[model samples]
Target: MPSQVEVMVKALSRLLGWIYTFCWSASFYPQPIYNLRRRSTKGLAIDFAAINVLGFICYMLYAASFLYSPLIRKQYAARNPISPDPTVRFNDLAFAVHAVILSIIVYSQFWPQIWGFRVSRYQHVSWPVAGLFWGCLLAILILTVVVVTQSPDGGSDPAYWAWIDVLYGLSYEKVLITIVKYCPQAWVNYKRKSTVGWSISQILLDLAGGVLSLAQLIIDASFQDDWSGVTGNPLKFLLGNVTILFDLVFVVQHYILYKSSGDGEDDNKAPDPRTPLLPEEQALQR
Candidate 1:
């Protein structure tokens, strides 16, 4: 029989899991919303989305791998036999699916507009090229998975240690992806001196989700007396803080740093009737 304290902790953990799930799933919607509202992908960077898709693929694989890993499952069963398995859950799967779908949507926005800018050296890369880049990345990921699964010793063979190493490496790659994910967008905002097409609300929601997710982990680790849940996945811990950091940088850029520049001019001055609407604006007007 479980102790009263264990029961309470389990219930709290479940509740926190649901909250984290919702926040994580909802975080993917903001950029798509901004794209729809603006009807343009002008300032958004394609590489960021491309790299993000790859990172999400790795994350999905990592989560799924945990579900099948005998060692991981056994560990969970031993630790909390009465409670649900924590390795992979509906919310975790949903987060993975949401990420892939969102990445595809963001990638799709690069077309047609990219074609229009083909003559410019700055916009030389096309959607197809981006697709090719993603294809290469996908191939590499598939190859890695194949190698991991085919290990002769399987999970038990010391040779199988390579598989664990790969998983850890992939997790670290997610951290790297998170670190660089916002760079291109930030650069775009800087060069254009505006964040008009970006959604600040989305950033706020993302930050909120990240902070809550971290809190949930802290709670679980605290009550369980097993810091391995954290140390085992350092990237997840780092990801939350890193996300909040970048979001703050964006907030400052949008509100203070670029307040007097870019679209700020348009906000302050009367419209010049002679100035033609941007392609996206024209599309919306029509």
Candidate 2:
């Protein structure tokens, strides 16, 4: 039997969890919509989409394994002996699955044949960026093979523990991917001096999600009086904060620095938004 205060706190935590899940999941929609209406992915970074798809896939793996695998849960308990509160919630798993689907949709928009959208010739992901995504995928593939080969038996053997470690490593990989994924988009916005193709709605929703996510973690940890719930899962904590920082960067790029001017609006329908501004055209804007 729980006390009244305990019940209320648990209820509040659940509410926050759902709200942030909705926010983060819904955040994926605006970009595809924006691209559809614009009929172009001119200012959107291909690298951003590529990296985002991979990141969410990793997150899905992490959440699903933790929630479904008793062995993995055992591994978590072994690693973190102190904090015993729930780290991965239903909402977290839901968000991860939703994000992975939406991220794939968004990434598909980058290709001309898939969505039949026009993209500027200049709008291509650099070789290094492509290499980065492939490199990450290869690492995940190799580790997956190791986990499969090493954990043939279901017992709590060393090989089984190694598989658990790989699952846990995916969580950290997601955090790293989140940190890197934003860079290309931010750089694109800076280079173009605009955020015309990028969706600010996505950023706003992501910010809401990130803030609520961090708040929910704090509340749950406090309620359990087990700070290890937050501290032990440092990657999750770091992911929320890192997402918030990049969302802020995008907000500033969209709202503060490169806000649209009526006279020089970046036409969404333009076949090539990457066309360089002539000296006279640049002078007039100044």
TM-score of each: 0.74, 0.86
User: What shift in Å separates residue 228 of candidate 1 from its native position after superposition?
Assistant: 1.2
What is candidate 1's local distance difference test score? 0.66
lDDT of 2: 0.80
Q: Which residue runs of candidate 1 sit more than 4 Å off their true CA positions?
A: 71-90, 113-155, 158-162, 260-286
Taking every candidate in turn, the Cα RMSD to the unseen true structure, in Å, is 6.5, 4.3
Q: What TM-score does candidate 2 reach?
A: 0.86
Q: Worst 10-residue stretch by lDDT in candidate 2?
A: 261-270
lDDT of 1 at 47: 64
Candidate topping TM-score: 2
| Residue pairs with clashing backbones, model 2 | none
